[model samples]
Target chain A: MVNDNILGIIAGILTSLAMLPQLLKVLKEKNVDDLSPLMLITLILGLSLWVWYGVFKRELPIIYSNAFAVLVNLSLLSCYFLYRKSG
Target chain B: MVNDNILGIIAGILTSLAMLPQLLKVLKEKNVDDLSPLMLITLILGLSLWVWYGVFKRELPIIYSNAFAVLVNLSLLSCYFLYRKSG
Candidate 1:
């Protein structure tokens, strides 16, 4: 059986880490130009739901990771918007 | 109060949708070159955890979203590895 505490911690770190490639790609390429609006909009909604689910469950890992994901998504979205506006 | 069923459905759609940006960006840019292995590794772990969390809560949204997210992550990771190998 998996240790619940360790699993939660590992899950948190990994989930957050998953954002890195997108973050790095956006940062390195500076080309959020092709990112879709529907995608971002949907993701934000999803993240919002995850956050709500976390709160309902009182699970810190879900709460923290999804919250952080919202920020990452927002940041990426903002960059995408900026790219569009500038272009 | 929000309808839990509706919320779960919305959450599932949103979470899955969230992966679109990354998918599109990777697709368009064809540059998973800079993606980090540690990040991919961590994300898989997190996604797995989220899936478990979903199972525990009996939440369809979490299950579907995280499952989809895992595929998205794996696809991206495979591309990154290919990029790394090629260059």
Candidate 2:
């Protein structure tokens, strides 16, 4: 990719891996009871909006990256729900 | 604010709060020994560059939100270091 496109790719990678620390923590602990469900929900909703914005602008970089980011967050959310102990 | 502006603000809030779940979990657990330090460092660097990009574009929403985000991540990193035990 070109130099300009490199930023987009970097952004994409950063955005996708941003949650790695939290996901790693959750997995190693085998519990996510303490993770904020509200925070994750807001992220999902907000990033969805960003994806829409990217579509409206016809910006492939933003759209593709945010789309992938959604999957990352969704996976963490799933683990959060799955491993959480009902209290 | 206009609808477009609302999106910017929403994006701002989400960008900042996106890390809340992880921070909350860290505080609750008082441990980030398992969390990916490399992940956090990369995020900080990437977002810093994003901040620079925002400045390059004179995009207040991106710059401002990401500036606050750096603070948020730094706080988390501090907590991570303070509470983490060497094992």
DockQ of predictions, in order shown: 0.58, 0.45
Candidate 2 docks with a DockQ of 0.45
Lowest summed lDDT across 10 adjacent residues in model 1 chain B is found at B78-87
TM-scores of chain B alone in all candidate structures, in the order given: 0.82, 0.82
For all candidates in order, state the fraction of native interface contacts they contain.
0.76, 0.38
Given candidate 2, what's the lDDT at residue B66? 72
Per-residue lDDT of model 1, residues A1-87, tens digit only = 765556666777777777767867887788875567778778887887878877876777778877888888888888887766553
Give the B-chain TM-score of model 1: 0.82
List ranges where model 1 is wrong by over 4 Å.
A1-6, A24-29, A83-85, B21-31, B34-37, B81-87
- Model 1, docking class: medium
Once superposed on the true structure, which residue ranges of model 2 sit more than 4 Å away at CA? Answer: A1-3, A24-30, B24-30
